[model samples]
Target: MTRSELLNDLEQSLTRLVDGMLVDKGRSIEFLTRLDRLDDIAIDMARGINADARLAGFFADNTPWLLDEDLTTAQKGRAGTLFAEITDLLAARTDEEGLKLGREAEEWSRAMGGRPLRLVLRATREEASLSDRFHALLRREAEEVNMLLAEREHLMTCLDDVLSSAELKRDRMHHHLAASLIYFLKMEGYKVEPYVRRLRRITEILEKEKPC
Candidate 1:
């Protein structure tokens, strides 16, 4: 074959390979986007749970001491308003609505004699619950991502085997890309580990003792 003809054939082959890679990348991106949306919803649910947990804990912690005092009608009104504000925020899905409610709750809590120490303790309890729920979802997602990674790896491995049998050089490029994708998922899974461990520890302690 003439040199020009050989070059032309090679160019066509590379073009087709690039097109296939683009298609695969598009599929991967779409799948990951869906995963991202699921993650966002899980986070929002966990946040709502955290908000409600905080309000409940605040009342539990302070109602004892506050009830001992002869609270004014205005003080009682503000406390009820704070509780309602927190409840509203817990029910809110939109960030704007939640933020507005959060601000109102903060103001009401302050006006109703919320102490910083009590607030901190209540916040910790809320955060613990949020972490617990988030970790549960995270573990499930991790397993899903791991399964996806394994599937992709298996497919890529098969592709590599086929390409090797056919003596195709392009398979090397695909194998490289597949490995990179797997590494990215592993990195993300690693990022979620600490929270999972925290949740596990909390669960262990809770199981060991009964709530009074």
Candidate 2:
């Protein structure tokens, strides 16, 4: 594969690994503990890249500063750009919308003097987090995957408690957060989920979501 192809493959592999880590936190820790496997894969990829004579020749022929022993401005720019690309890929943040929000937030921060502007931006971010993470679950899994009917009912009751609370419903972001929290509980299987508090603390944090 070409260098771009190799990098794209690595990015896809990393993104899938991150998704697996998010979905299975318990096993993810075990996977993380076995860092040697990751090291081996990275080393193998590096060796494969090094073995690509044409890939090296392409870089040598195109890059004027390739043979420079001293780090030039071009080298610094390339390094910074590559680092940013890797960061964006790993974070799954390819959209310009988040950057647009940030630029707007910066302008508002200058106008409003920091704290107040931050509250508004926080609200915006929380609102933007409305993507339903549990939407992709198979219908049969939700019905029959290692969960009893009673446990499912228990989860439903918990969700009801969140929705039924006047306190949670007072603020839209809090309401959304409560729904998300419950969705996660259900997704993780109701039998193994933790107890829900009155959510007073979360609401208190949600206090910041109220832009002055």
Ten residues in a row with the worst lDDT in model 1? 165-174
Task: Estimate the overall C-alpha local distance difference test score of candidate 2.
Answer: 0.38
Clashing pairs in 2: none
Model 1, 1-212: lDDT tens per residue?
89999999999999999999997677555444433332333334434444434344444455453453444343344343333334333444457645654554565546655322122124577796566444433433334334344435643343333233223222222233333434554565534343334334444544555346
Candidate 1's TM-score: 0.31
**Per-model RMSD to reference:** 22.0, 21.5
Report clashes for each candidate as comma-separated counts: 0, 0
lDDT of 2 at 132: 21
Number of colliding residue pairs in model 2: 0
Name the candidate that leads on lDDT: 1
Clash pairs for candidate 1: none
**Model 2 regions lying over 4 Å from their true place:** 1-169, 190-212
